[model samples]
Target chain A: MSELVHPLHRFIRPSVKYSTFCPGCGDGTVTQAILRAIDGLGMNLDDFVFVSGIGCAAWIPSPFFNADVLHTTHGRPIAFAFGIKMGLPDKKVMVVSGDGDLVAIGGNHLIQNARRNIEMVVLCINNGIYGMTGGQAAPTTPMGIRTTTTPYGTVENIFNISRLVMAAGASFVACWTAAHPKQLTNSIKKAIQKKGFAFIEVFSQCPIQFGRKTGVGSAVQMLEDYKKRSISPKEAAKLSEEELKDRIVVGELVDLEKPEMLEEVKKMKNKARGEVE
Target chain B: MNGKRVQTGRYFMMGNVACAEGALAAGCEFSAGYPITPATEVANRLAERLPQVGGAFFQMEDEISAIAAVVGASWAGKKSMTVTSGPGISLMLENIGFAIGVETPCVIVNVQRGAPTTGMPTVGVQGDMVQAKRGSHGDYEIIALCPSSPQEMFDHTVIAFNYAERYRTPVFILSDAFVGHMREEVVIPEPEKIKTEYRKIPEPGTDPQKIKGFLDEDVAPMPIFGRGFKAHVTSSCHDEYGKRNLIDISALDNFIRKLSNKILKHKEEITLIERDYEGAEIVLVSYGAVARAAAMAAAQGRKEGIPVGTLRLITVWPFPGEEIEKMARGAKHVIVLENNLGQIYPYIKAEAAHDAEVSFLPPRLVGEIQDPEDILRKIREVSK
Candidate 1:
């Protein structure tokens, strides 16, 4: 008989003993899904560089990943990823940040990078509320949800982050929840293999800040809700817009070929150097 | 023309274009910026020049992202830069602080325009002088260079990059519209003649656990990305190994002191001053475009037999107090000149006031260069 070790243990830094996430938080599940995806693809952490911004989901990479990690200012990870990708065009650059980070303050960088079609994988962990700042209302928070900042209930409409990235010209777009870790991991694998700006919006549960305080119930209850509300894009295609309003549309929305930014830049450089017409 | 890294010939070039050429000669591999008046020419030149040299320039959405990208590129083991004006610098302050906190080596060019808030886009002013030093929140030291002419714009930009790389901090090229757009003869030296520096990085196979990548008084080897260093870079207070230590009061103190000390410890090598104040009773002190006028005034004052000399601050931050004190001790009266209403005067006085009487000579009006005749008159009055 041999002692068993966690297969995904090698991906984490030797110095990091525990994750900073709260108990049963979906961010941990998402972390496992990401590490599983990287491991499943037979790629080591050495070839990848992880970038994150300020928030709970941002903590998913820094100090945890045994790779080069850049934990940047709030809402600026994607912008920083642009430079990292440009500098090391062959190396895989990934950004893991939250909904408020990638959508609200960092929306311009997201839209612009997607439009440029730069090669990077952006994992936008959407937990509906600002968990790090004590359950403040976020841009992805559904209307009428009571958060710390929205005591009277949020009056603003929530951002459809997948649709936003899709419209911004991302080459790959997908949505999944923590409840579907297998599918989420599969999408991460696909995103890593894709060429241009790939975005995955993971609907994660914040059991502490976004759970009982907001009436979303316990961690188990939130997972059940996510499992029940998630509908496949194919299945949702058969429903009317009114009937599908409450359903979370899951799966790949767009994945196809396009001229990526760095590839075009290479050609442009050659043209400028008079090496090619 | 596109493939050439240095146009090694003398040409009457605009100060902004000279700066771009200087960056190329300094081996800047990545450039990112947004277009703004007076500074756009630097971006335009770089946009056209960088690609030919197997480098790239990105025109980001805003100044915030522009500086952020430069910092990221620097961590990716490339010498990077960003150019902008005063309003843009305001947008970049937070990320600039991030660069300082993480010890990222990058150059920032502020082709300054008149401002409180977009005050004048085309006119030159030195209003952002102190901003380059103290605009970011917190207590930290910075390195800044003031280039007064098109030639110095080219020369100082190279020096800026060297200081940034050597010190592992953001170095500012503080130019104004008068200097940035001024057309003058700029000599681009052969590539071999230019001295450029690259930041030291840890040996390729050094144990990741043993790598002390940050907070060394003598400047630690940068554990830049993509080299198996597995560096963990964050703005939060940390120890020498780049580990985040948010809980300790002593750790925060070390984080702040060690970063500032990294540059301050090298003050002798970092400070640059041009002095001709020997045997003079009244000395005119200035920097940037205003220094050109100060030089002319001092020269004219000497012709009239008044004992007047000039001390031009080439390296403006770490504040150059020692140089100022030395200059003041030799002179009875010190007059500080600036295009704006005395942005650096208080700092100058703090250093010089104990030795000599210090006075600020603002332009007759903001955005106007001090007339050489008016400066001479002031010199004569002060000497009397």
Candidate 2:
């Protein structure tokens, strides 16, 4: 009889025999979706580079992926990926980071890279709490959510990262939960092919650190909640503000063309050399 | 023996501009910096010149991001650097530690201005001498060079890159506003004439999977990303293959020790000193722009029959303790001059204490160079 192999076996590192995620965690699901997206596009692994910052989401690519990876400092993956893209203009660079790693400390880099229309894709896993640091409240943590840092409840309003990136001028933006694996995979594939700053926020389930405190129940229950709460942008537009207040706005938020930073840089170089008008 | 210039063309240039040109000549392909006084010219010049040479230049959002970007560029197989002042250096301390942890090869130019906070924006001070060594939050050794003139600014920048690449650590060009803003004639050597060094890469067929640590006692060759090496670099305490080993005591010890010993073991080759201590009763120990005044004082002291000499430190970190010990043994007294309240004075005194008497000449509170006459007067009193 033939031996059974994992679907992502070809893309994952052989030495990383076990997943680092907690039981029933969504990180592994998101990892599989990303690998599936790359496999579907038939992209050469040699041309892909993964850049990540501190957190569990950052580990999604570091020691696991077969491709080149840079596990950088906290909240600085986008800034680091900017350098990598600038150095190797032809290579496809991608950043994987957690909500705290992206919006809390690294927000400046995210906004600036988007404003410049730098050519790279960013996948931010918004689990609503700092998982690696034991469930502290994050920027994306919802109001009234109980966390280690917010015993009574969070006082700050949650930041809608999808809307934030869209306003920051990303060429492409989308949101999906790990429950919607197929759609998440498709969105990732499109993001990979986009010419300039693409950002996708994956609303992943953090059962151990986030779910237990918020009364979100088991991992299976959280996935079910995602299925029930998610709405398409078109559907969201049709609903009243009150009706859409607590819903997860899933699907592509923005897709438009603009001059990419690195391409403009090349053009400027040519013009300076008197090769272009 | 005069070496041929790599891109030989002499030009009268500001010290900051000379530093930029020196980086270009040294094959630095990437630079990321934020604009700050005194050091802004380095970024301004690189912005105009880097793209012309097929190199990349970025004006990052802040000093923290600027240094972070340069560290990233280094791992991408580009020789990278960042230029900033004291306040900017303060913002970059954490990332500097990150670079040390990963053993990334890059250069950092700190054109220091007077500061406890934002003390003096337009004037020079050597207040950050110790900060450059201990600013980061870990036990690590860094290479720092001081330049007294535009010519040295240009020359030292090239040497800084060479040392950074050779040792796979962040090397510092610790220039001050006095030298960074000064204008002088600088000879641009031909590209071939300027010597350069690059971090060693793993052999072509070496499996990336088999690799353990990126550095050892002899400093392992750098294995960058996208070369099929799959080099796993992290800021956490890591093993030989760049894998995190948080609880493993041996792994932590090996990693931290190698990070320091790589530069410390080669202290002789890495340290650079300029001395003229023959038959001298008193010596002035100094660096950066203060060294210029110290040199003048020594010359004036000799005229007055004071028998003074100068021991100018070109490479400041690893502290050049051996050279200090030797100089102290031969002289009766050593005067340490700096633009701050004795930042490097203690180290000098510690090295020379058993052999000779060491004293400090602190900066004039009004933010002016210690006048040559003031230093000479101190020399006369100390000699007696």
Strongest candidate by TM-score: 1
Write model 1 residue lDDT over A123-202, tens digit each, in one string. 99998999988999998888898989999999997788999999999999999999999999999999999999999999
TM-score of chain B of 1: 0.99
Off by over 4 Å in 1: A1-3, A275-277
Interface RMSD of 2: 5.3
Off by over 4 Å in 2: A275-277, B1-7
What lDDT score goes with residue B297 in model 2? 87
Please give, for residues A59-162, the per-residue lDDT of candidate 2 as tens digits: 99988887778888888999889888887788889999899999999999999899999999999999989999999999999889989999999999888898
Report DockQ per prediction, comma-separated.
0.71, 0.53
**Model 2, C-alpha of A19: deviation from truth (Å):** 1.4
TM-score, first chain, each model: 0.97, 0.97
lDDT by residue for model 1 over B219-313, one digit each (tens)? 99999999999999999888999999999999999999999999899998999999999999999999989988999999999999999999999
TM-score of each: 0.99, 0.97
Per-residue lDDT for B3-37 in model 2, tens only? 21134677788999899989988989899999999
